[model samples]
Target: MSSAALPTSALAISAAIRSGSLSATDVTRAALDLVSARDGEIGAFTTVTAERALNEAQAVDRLRAEGSKLGPLAGVPYGVKDLFDIKGLSTLAGSKINRTRPPADADAVLIQRMTAAGAILLGGLNMGEFAYDFTGENAHHGPSRNPLDTKRMSGGSSGGSAAAVAAGFLPLSLGSDTNGSIRVPSAFCGLYGLKPTYGRLPRTGTFPFCDSLDHLGPFARTVGDLALCYDVLQGWDGGDVACVDRPSEQASQELAKGATGLRTAVAGGYFRRGADPSAIAAVDRAAHALGASEEIDIPDVTRARAAAFLITNAEGSALHLDNLRHRAEDFDPDTRDRFLAGAMLPASWYIAAQRFRLQFEAAMRKVFSEFDILLAPSTPFSAPLLGQKTMMLGGSEVPLRPNIGIFTQPISFIGLPVAAVPVRVDGPMPYGVQVIARPWREDLCLRAAAVIEAAGVAHMTPSSL
Candidate 1:
């Protein structure tokens, strides 16, 4: 069967492969063909591992032929953000200098998990330089255009992950979110993306951005597919110090529960301010779909966002101080400047942000004690024009890069789980809403997202590209 004839979801593809209706080799070739034809326009993939993928797919087919039970992701092709280490490929975390690093001898922990579940790896995807920007524009690799509109932005760091899935080149892909990297891109590209609770998924073998805030998760067109990928990727890796040694919490099984008996609220006050009309409308629509009418104010949201910024800058900058000192000119100008500023920050400011972080987490815990889920805008607005530096927010023109994650920063600051579901508004580009749950409660977030998905208010629309 041709790629066009292949089923749209990963689970469906796996079932077809298991039943012998389709061969894993054929499915892998079909996906690679799509990437060959459309990826030039989207700039979604940095590399396409056709040879490696075909070999893996053939192995899956061999197992099925031998009467061995296949894994849940048996023949589904997927990609990961460039930060993830793939054996024999230098992990270019979207920078020019990383091209000189030696090839990785092993795969990232998450990659190992995906391989164990029988998923085929397509290749590495493009991202913002060193996971620093909100806009998807990358100087070394070029911008990863929005699948829905070539001229618009695709949101940052995880932009290629969202673009690849949204464009139908791949059914599932992985991305990292330090501060809204996955959510912002998913919202812009009109896909479902999950940012699991911090330390829930181990980060061994992946490039570091912010040690405390960094998280890796999946992107997909449907909520079930998203959860399926998440379930496969869950486990403890002793290699990663931040990883929590917890058993996998299967979210796919809990999806059918779908917002029943769950207490939900729409975030008000800080969440509503400075947001575009389309963003507010998207949140309202998602809230309505989940039967949430109560408005709740999350305390200290503004300060929480500020604290996140400080922590990210301090921690992220510390990782690249050597490069900033020696190869500053080789760095992306926007990323270099930000890292330089972060280096200048006093130790006291970093310490204070850490102190405030604990207090914020405690406050959020109390909020979660009262409500099961919270709904808010995933971004301030839809994707901005590609390479456009400034935008009007709150009736004043502001620098576009730092402000894109305003709503998302606060929630992630405290290591909460969030699901970003796309909602179509009056505009041509669709915005998204956040389904947030307390730490380690990704099941609740997915259940709420499933309810929104069931109502048809939040779903991925076909990309014109």
Candidate 2:
């Protein structure tokens, strides 16, 4: 493969390789070249494994020549967020505090699956410390710039994953969504990203911010690519307690039908409020594409967001309990006060949040009974300037981390599958709309998203980075 030819989607690269028009080795080289050229400016990666990628690419080429078998993801180059454990590499979780931790004993289950699928690891990318913050800014590793404009941001804790994909350095990346971590960055980057239903993908070996709420998913240039990665990574793992006995839905089945004949709705309430005008327009455009007519309010969202906050903070504070007690100075200042505050949270409040989860999820499930998919803005606005904090939305002031999750937390809180579609509607900031579906129905979300992408309603601008 020449440096000039890099496929941005699984559909393109897969077909090209199958037909011998493109070789995996060539694609790998091109991807590496992209990283070399643009990553210095974007800070999308915390590490890059050049030799590992080249070796994987060669193995793929051998398989291609033999015409024996090809995994669904053969030859795709991807960046794994630092939180995921990669064999022989220390998992940093984008924090300086974890820099001295020894290399992982084994790859995270999801990482092993991607490797088996013939995806090349381009090394770990940056993220919010301990995956606590919503903004992609890493006070420890420095900020990951938005691919669209170097001056702006890529939504965090999955910012690096989205930036790698959106900057065209890689076609795919792994991200975890504890609360809009994956979707926010994907939206800002104008790329397709999926946060699969909680437990749909095993999280063993992936650092956790919120045990009950964390989900592992993929960021990619297209819904199908996201599906391809999802299919490969999902299934039960005995090592992970959260891994459930759920049958994997066939990506070919849902994606084959595409977006035709799907019932869709535009979400209001939390989703409708506090977004840049362009973000709303993008939602409108997606609704129009899906032929959505009803504009329904998603009830219990405000409570859901509140509950998510309590749970995330509580669990997160516990995860770093020892560190907070003995080595608080080593923690990133960005999340230090927030975690300290959570440490003082009452036990009853945590319990109340759990109780609220059942009520909120029950209310959400009913809404799904009326609609196949729900659409809303991915963020209130595009990624703000690298160091900017506090965004005013719908005439209300909200902190950066919580505000980015405004339209997102309510949906993710209940473990629903969702796809963030990057919308290119005119705005001072670039943002995307999130399309959500009920648990285990990522098919519904991705199918609906494909429609808008096909119509060219969602597209990320090329980055100067």
Candidate 3:
């Protein structure tokens, strides 16, 4: 279990563990040592649960000793975004106000499942307060510095998750995508991140940023690790109303099918409208790998973005109505305005946004009827300055953090599966692109992403101080 033998994928870790060449405790300890050595700069985890992770690692090793079956993720250690509820731990959601909150009563379903599969939970990671922003710059928790470039932003609200994996602290991390949070940071940090079809993973225990758009997923150094986590995490969680009772066979059956003959297109129009050159080039590279055709537009992306904004604001504000009324001062200034702004949105506008989502979903289904996969930039640019609010995108200055959701919103608006691949490109904030598919079509999305990643046409940011 030397750090020299650190795995690049969770599947590889599982193999090592199963063959008695490595133990879960060794993998967990190595991850902790790396975090100890590196996280002061990365600032990925807000709370490092070292003792607990070690205990869990020992438990996993005990499972192996008892001749019990280990899951595909066995012996892997991953950071969890702070927003998810971890048993006996307060679900901070990266907010200062939550300092007084009590520990969780039980583990989130996804956490329990990963643990059952022998994965060790390292700790809760940093994020935008209450998952309100796109940049992983936390005023209270401190910004999650990009591993590739310390001065740049880590894409939020899953910034820490991305940094943790990208910095080699661990090969895998669990993150949530509410308007590209997972994909954006993963792109910036140069890692593989999947925003599975909405509800592909249950949201029952994750803090809600926007109920309509929230998605739970995995971040890793390779597509194979993404699949390993997905297989362990996806299933029917009866408590989560959005969870569809798909057969448990989904991940294993779909992953290696490959993207042969799949009709793919580069998303143009709004998707291409205001993105950085690095972002555009990354998508372009992916297009060539998939043999994608020229630009195809998904109508009304601008309006859809607005609608998504209204809904997110309204829902998020409502969720914290009591807190805003009394403890407003305790909230982070960067996100406080966003929450208060949401509180002022007219109820009627919120209703219209929901109705629009239905129509939007219908329109997307029609588009998918024609194409198998849609390719687009996960973030409009590579990571920006830690507190940056603007960027020159496609010849126009746009709000960087908020506008980062431009390309990702339209696809997630309809509950589609998207596997975001961080292609190697020369930049401070390494760019990444997403391969999106129709709802429940992660098979196609993963296939296209794997192809793009395997081509090695895109450059990956190296981890060096």
Instruction: Give the candidate number with the greatest lDDT.
Output: 1
Off by over 4 Å in 1: none
Off by over 4 Å in 3: 461-465
Query: Candidates 2 and 3: which is better by lDDT?
Result: 2
Instruction: Give the per-residue lDDT digits (tens) of candidate 3, residues 149-182.
Output: 8888888888899888877788889988878888
Model 2 lDDT tens row, 184-269: 88877888888888888889998888899999899888777888788888789988898788998877458767667778899886
Q: Lowest-lDDT window of 10 residues in candidate 2?
A: 456-465
Q: Which of the two candidates, 1 or 3, achieves a greater TM-score against the reference?
A: 1
Model 3's lDDT to the true fold?
0.83
Top candidate on TM-score is 1
Clashing residue pairs for model 2: 1-26, 136-156
Q: Give the clash count for model 3.
A: 3
**Winner by lDDT between candidate 2 and candidate 1:** 1
Candidate 1, residues 1-465, lDDT tens digits: the string is 566888889989998999999999999998998889889999999988889999999999999999998899999999999999999999999999899999999999999999989999999999999999788889999999998998999999898998898888899999999999999999999999999999999999999999999999999999999999999999999999999998898899999998888899999988888899889999999988989899988899989999999999999899999999899999999899999999999999999999999999898889889999999999999999998888888899999999999999998898899999999888689998999998899999999999999998885566324
Residue 311 in model 3: shift from native, Å? Answer: 0.2
Error of 2 at 139 (Å): 1.6
User: Model 1: what TM-score?
Assistant: 0.99
